[model samples]
Target: MNEKVSSSIPEAEAVIDTTPDNGQEGRIIMPEAERARISKESKKEEAWYSGEPFSSWEEVEVAVNEGLLVPVADSDHYKVSANAVEGGRYLTPVAKKMLDLVAGEWSKKMKKKGEDIDSLFLIVTSMTRIVSYQDGLSKKGFPTADSSNPRKSTHLRGGTFDLAFKWLKENRSVAYKILLEVLRDLHKKEQINLIEETTIGVLHVCVNPDKAKRRSSSRRLAGTGSAKR
Candidate 1:
């Protein structure tokens, strides 16, 4: 009998030290003030890209079908969780492009380190979410932002994603460091906004809309097509 492939990836045992002081050197920490500022800025950008918040899963599907939101699947550098796909596996074009750029840079860095890039991939734990799902999570004490307030969560706008850090730290320690380096570089360039959600053990990332627009325009002017889903 043939074995069926599991939809979910199994998390590796916690081999790496989880202590706060262990491997703390050169770690990127986003200050609370910076996170607050970025949160506001990201909300504005999200509003610009996704007009009204998705109130239901049907609305999310409609947006996907209409191309307002693009589906993100497993790729060479990243893997979307089964739960993320089932909840809402979509993002704005600019956000998706940003994700690709981050993952691509991390892959390059991993290759330079002589690591097996194929074995290292970022695990996306969450993506765009409908209001109902968000509410459900909130009720379950999942630390979800307020779903009633459209400006509260970028995930509602399909412009944010959560990367599972605990799994990466325990399983792919080197890749996790490289990933942080890539994120730090991008954040310095003001190309993205990041929030380290310690309570959730995930890094929440939001792409900067202005930078994405500028890059898209530059590409067009250079006769290069815009990034596709």
Candidate 2:
């Protein structure tokens, strides 16, 4: 994977690229204030990898407090514009990266299909979860296949997230094909383990935490190298 040049915020985020341009080496020139801001916000709270799943949200909180959980975001790829089933957007950093790339490809595909792409976005139904949240959903008779065991759940590991496919099917069928195409690409790359949950009408995307770790590590190394001028 190509290394990243910088960090994030939202649509205004900038990523550096050191490739030569017009016979000159590429340079990154962020305003001093912006650079400082990026440095401050980009400081990772912790370096975390998925491990034993927790039996409850309480346990999840313990790990979070210990700097063992990396927060995800509602970035450009899988946006939480509406129809959100969860409160926050949090995934393992690797999973987030995978989502951004694959989802961007999906958007392109939608445009090729002659679909209106100006304001299209996916509805995120679920992201990182705790055992208590799973239980609550189960009690409400939500259609998830046995999330009682943390180890067995990709959600707990921050390896899995869900897209509200049913919402698209009912409200935006034109984009459905694009979503599938993106999923196919992701699966082929071995970057995700996906399941089209017919019962719940959602698409689950699971990241291999180990793979994500390697990918994120490489990005950091590339960033550090590029920052050397």
Candidate 3:
């Protein structure tokens, strides 16, 4: 530990002694302001560029096989055709909302910029996965799969999903800018966790399940009340 003498303790005798007999209780005494600053620095939030970390990949696979994960295609927020990509198509409700919010915001921003937006389609790069499937992908040296653990991936639990930048770009340079803006907005609101794999050109995001469920319930109640009126 680099001990810098604080301005509050000018005298050499007042310096925090590094005597071995003092034990763990021998901590430096500083002004209340300095103490608060140290406390704040220690409790700072983690950088927003990484998704939720998981342990015990086996448990995640169990959740997937038990049919606990919900399908994203069932949600109204996203558009899926009969030719949707195989696998990774399913996601938890919360993840679905995160995708929807981003897509919706992206569309709105494009429209505001006076760009034609009708031809664009939001692509779902990866979704729910099983342990075996993830393992196979990892063995093939897939970039996204390499970052995910077969047993611990949020994909297995339908809690996470990925979107490729190419699909969003669709030949438009501003697509990624819109994506970043949407991510910033959602993350600020604590609605989703996001990580941009710049090398792979993919955006990996996960929504908070608790927040999604509560919002869904509130929407339902509001709809019912409106109907009664």
Best by lDDT: 1
Q: Pairs clashing in candidate 3? A: 57-151, 57-152, 88-127
By TM-score, the better pick of 1 and 2 is 1
Error of 2 at 191 (Å): 1.7
- Badly placed stretches (over 4 Å) of model 3 are 1-70, 74-88, 143-149, 167-170, 213-229
| Residue pairs in clash, model 1 | none
Q: Give the per-residue lDDT of model 3 (tens digit) for 86-170.
A: 5556655556557777788887886787665554444555676665776655454333322333344445456666665643443
TM-scores for every predicted model:
0.71, 0.60, 0.55
Instruction: Kindly indicate the candidate among 1 and 3 with the higher lDDT.
Output: 1
> For residues 1-229, could you state the per-residue lDDT of candidate 1 as single tens digits?
1122122344421221112332545233434555454445444334333344578888878777766678899898788765464848888777888889888998898878876754556778788887677666555334433324433566777777878777666556787888899898877776676766654567878776666764322221112322221
- Please state every model's RMSD to the true fold in angstroms: 9.5, 19.1, 19.5
Instruction: Please identify model 1 stretches exceeding 4 Å from their true place.
Output: 1-8, 12-50, 85-87, 144-151, 214-229
Using TM-score as the measure, the top candidate is 1
- lDDT of model 2 at position 191: 56
- Residue 43, candidate 3: alpha-carbon lDDT: 22
